[model samples]
Target: MKNTLKISLKAGEKIYVNGAVIRVDRKISLEFLNDVQFLLQQHVLQPEDARTPLRQLYFIVQVMLMGQAGEGMEKTRQLFRDTLANLLSTFRNERIRAELKHIDTLVGQGKVYEALKAIRALYPIEEQIFNKDSLQEEQVFAKAVGE
Candidate 1:
């Protein structure tokens, strides 16, 4: 048998498990005796917070994991595939691209939490790329104006 997973949640904290939203009335600990998909409240990304490409992709995968009643699951999966393909083509950094492939493998294996963690780890690298691109755009604008 697989080992159990234990989770503790504070009062008012929410957890998404197998497409169900659960809010604790008080501090409580939960033990999952079997395999399950879950996302803690702190890790749940709000729609407004999905401002970048990776964040957007994360949101889609998050939906696939948290969506209730399996509604629109196939569509969400398709979106995940489409978004992942775009991200693979869009990123030039070898590290990000390589990690993305790993994330794809994790997702395919139904390891959503691990895939989310992998995606979260890439945010800093993505931010650096974003800053660099912004700086380049600013420099190009300055040159055009001066010319």
Candidate 2:
């Protein structure tokens, strides 16, 4: 049996369901009793906002979710896998690296939404790693100048 899903939306909120975007002008509650694919507006990333490599992947998956799965699904899936492979190759953090496998599983099962969430959660770690690298470089540069 499919567990029912209840979603409450405020005015002007949007939800993408099965590749269709629906916006409510007023407060509303919705329930889905069957299998449904839906994404909240807050999680939606615009094209320009996808500046980071991970975010770019998110945007591409979002396009597939946005109803482009007809003619370009194979292409999208290939790209997602390729990008994920590259990430796995270079990611230094064990936590993030481990998640790549789970994310791949989700994407392979057509659970792109869950895959996106897993990737999104890794962003803070990615930023922290980048910041640490920058700080280390600055320290090294300062040490060389002082020597």
Candidate 3:
């Protein structure tokens, strides 16, 4: 079975896919594009499914880091980073709330690595919204304590 997907490109161009890209002359809605991209990044398209594109991306990164460089790996990494940044910007409130909850959970369990991973993930977007020095201080202290 073949599945069709629609993606909007920058400059109001719409691309359709039946597993292959086809250009459409009509202008695409940026809001629609943003919504689709956000949903993909958040793994919301199949909320009950075990496998998702985001999970696939994470697995791809892990596999790439293991051995042999694959074609377009750098582009894949950049796409993941850009998608994550976009999601962070578009869902700032929800993302921040989720981050705080994760932080509390990690701290309670004494899982410094997981907490640091979460912080680093948010650092790109949260740097402007949060106090960097204080976060770094806490991270350093956690490291010093063998966490």
Each model's lDDT: 0.93, 0.85, 0.43
**Ranking, TM-score, top scorer first:** 1, 2, 3
Estimated TM-score for each candidate: 0.93, 0.91, 0.25
Q: Is candidate 2 or candidate 3 better by TM-score?
A: 2
What order do you get sorting by lDDT, best first? 1, 2, 3
Q: Candidate 2 lDDT (Cα, whole model)?
A: 0.85
- Which candidate leads in lDDT? 1
Candidate 1 local lDDT, 1-147, one digit each (tens): 899999999999999998889999999999999999999999999999999999998998898788634547888898999999999999999999999999999999999888999999999999999999999999999999999
Residue 122 displacement (Å), model 3: 13
- As a whole number from 0 to 100, the lDDT of residue 107 in candidate 2 is 74
Candidate 2 segments exceeding 4 Å error: none
Pairs in steric clash, model 2: none
Model 3: CA > 4 A from native = 1-71, 94-147
Q: How accurate is candidate 1 locally (lDDT)?
A: 0.93
